[model samples]
Target chain A: MPPISFALWLLVLVFDTGGQLAFKAASGVPGEGLGHWRAMAVRPWLWLGIAAFTCEFVTWLAFLSVVPLAEGVLLSCLNMAAVMLGGRWLFGERLTARRLLGVALITLGVVLVGAG
Target chain B: MNTRWRFYLVGFLLLMAIDTGAQLCFKLAATHAAPFAADPGWLLRVLREPWVYGAIAGYLGAFVTYMTLLKHAPVGPAFAASHLQVVSVMAASAWLFGERLAPLQLVGAALIVLGILVLARAEDEVAQTTPGHAR
Candidate 1:
């Protein structure tokens, strides 16, 4: 891929990571404070997440506009890697030895999948 | 390869990544934010955030990707590949949000990843055998 395309892919990755984080945050919050509708209208940050998701969808469409379905889907495997990295770095999530091992194996599997 | 398809693929991957990341953030935000105080009020409060908007955008992007993938690839493989989101999201949820998965769930995630990898390899083999131009 060209450098620019690579950058765009990176952008998509970042946005996706952001979106997932937002969902977790929303779901994790306790209690139904203002009901569903009221909460949606009042929270600006929530909208921010929604916007991120919108960007993600648009980017996906843009990707489909060019690449074949199979290739596009295959390339998306990289998202798992991105999440793993993001979870570790941004969230301070524990990478248990077992989980790390799983990640390593998964990485190898992804390589094979990409190469095959 | 056509530059457009290459761009699309990259864009799709980025969106997927952002989607996953945003979910994590939302979870974090939830931890800090007040618990749902009222049904509709809380729901509205959560939905109105810009982050939520971004996630909505990402979902749309994913929808487009899915449609295009279906258009270009066989449904079976496309569906299989799309399911990666499940693994990505769940694993992140467990680690970032402290959501514990049973040992069985962890094993299930591994199985899903393994199955997809195998399928991806099969697709690659088929692609290699085909005589069409890369683009």
Candidate 2:
């Protein structure tokens, strides 16, 4: 991949992972019904997530403009692994053996898609 | 299926449809505003496309549907079900946009889906084993 495309792809990954993590944090608060939505609305994490997604939306569009839609989408799957790691690091989520195996397989699959 | 199961099934299906539609719209918007530049002009070009709005609408719809579904659905299965859009988008791109994946890429896609399934099962197992665990 060219430098520009690689940059755009990286940006998309960063923003997507960040966005997902932020949303997770925002939603972790305990509530139900309209109160849940209202609570999240007042939180910075939710807004941050929305902002990151807005950035990701643009970056993803830019990335797709440079690569085939199919390839771009496949490559974007790496966000799953990235988010999982973020969860482990930030939220203290346990990375069990099975989860690790799953992450490894996903990483390998992404590599093949990126290289092929 | 029970009404509750039926609700989940419909919700997940709707999520997948919205996600797939969003991806296709993004692609269409990108194509319509081709020759991407890292500039305001390029951004403006993208904004001018109706498909971009379609993509935005899809995103909003998917978000609302996903949040609603997540309340009643298991996180593990819900996560995996949401991602099934990857497959749907791939098929749609091939059929509608004439995008062809290389043989290796096709294999890669399969592996990715399988990995997701494994992860989903792992999540369920972990949740079950860890008493008082909040996911």
Candidate 3:
């Protein structure tokens, strides 16, 4: 891979992982229905998530501009793993054997589609 | 089903719907502005396309639905579940665009569904053991 493509891929991964973790943090607020939405609206984490996602979109578009869409899709599958690790590290979410097996299987499935 | 499972089912379905809608909108936008070029005219055409706005709306709708689901659903499985759109988009393309579905892709789609079922069972187990756990 070229340097520019590699850089764009890295950017895509970072932005996507950051965006998701931020959203998870933001969504941890308490309440229900409209009240929950209102509470999250007043917080900064939600905006942070949105901003990261916007950046991710731009970076991802750039990545796909250089890389083939198939390879891009395959690479993007790593974001799921990245987010899962982030959830475990930052949020203390459980990562049982069953969950790991499930994620691994899904990642393989996506890889097959991308490679096919 | 209990209220918790009902919430998961409804929320995930809505998310998948929004995601499929967004992909379709983007496909329409691209088709409308075909023969891609690196020029102002092509950019202008994409900007002028109504489907582009629909795509943006779909993105917003998906974002809201995802965040709502994240309130209770774990990010890992929720994200995996979110990719169900891949299967939906493939099916849509097959039906609407007359695209051919490779056998490998079909196998892959099946694997993805199986993975989600396992993850769902994991979540159910966790929920049963710890009543107040969000996932």
Q: Report the number of the highest-TM-score candidate.
A: 3
Report fnat in order of the candidates: 0.02, 0.32, 0.60
TM-scores of chain B alone in all candidate structures, in the order given: 0.68, 0.77, 0.96
Candidate 1 lDDT by residue in tens digits, A21-74: 554334333334346435544655456667887898888777766666546555
- Candidate 1 regions exceeding 4 Å error are A1-116, B1-15, B25-39, B128-130, B133-135
Across B39-127, the per-residue lDDT of candidate 3 in tens digits comes to 99998999999999999999989988898899988887888778788878888989988988888999888888888888888888878
TM-score of each: 0.43, 0.70, 0.93
Q: Which candidate is the best by lDDT?
A: 3
Candidate numbers sorted by TM-score from highest down: 3, 2, 1
DockQ of 3: 0.72
Per-residue lDDT tens digits for candidate 2, residues A1-116, read 99999999999989988887777777676688789889888989889988999999999988999999768966887787777777778776777787777766666666565556
The pairs that clash in candidate 2 are none
Model 3: lDDT of residue B2: 88
Give candidate 3 misplaced runs (Cα > 4 Å). none
State which candidate, 1 or 3, has the greater lDDT. 3
The best-first sequence of candidates by lDDT reads 3, 2, 1
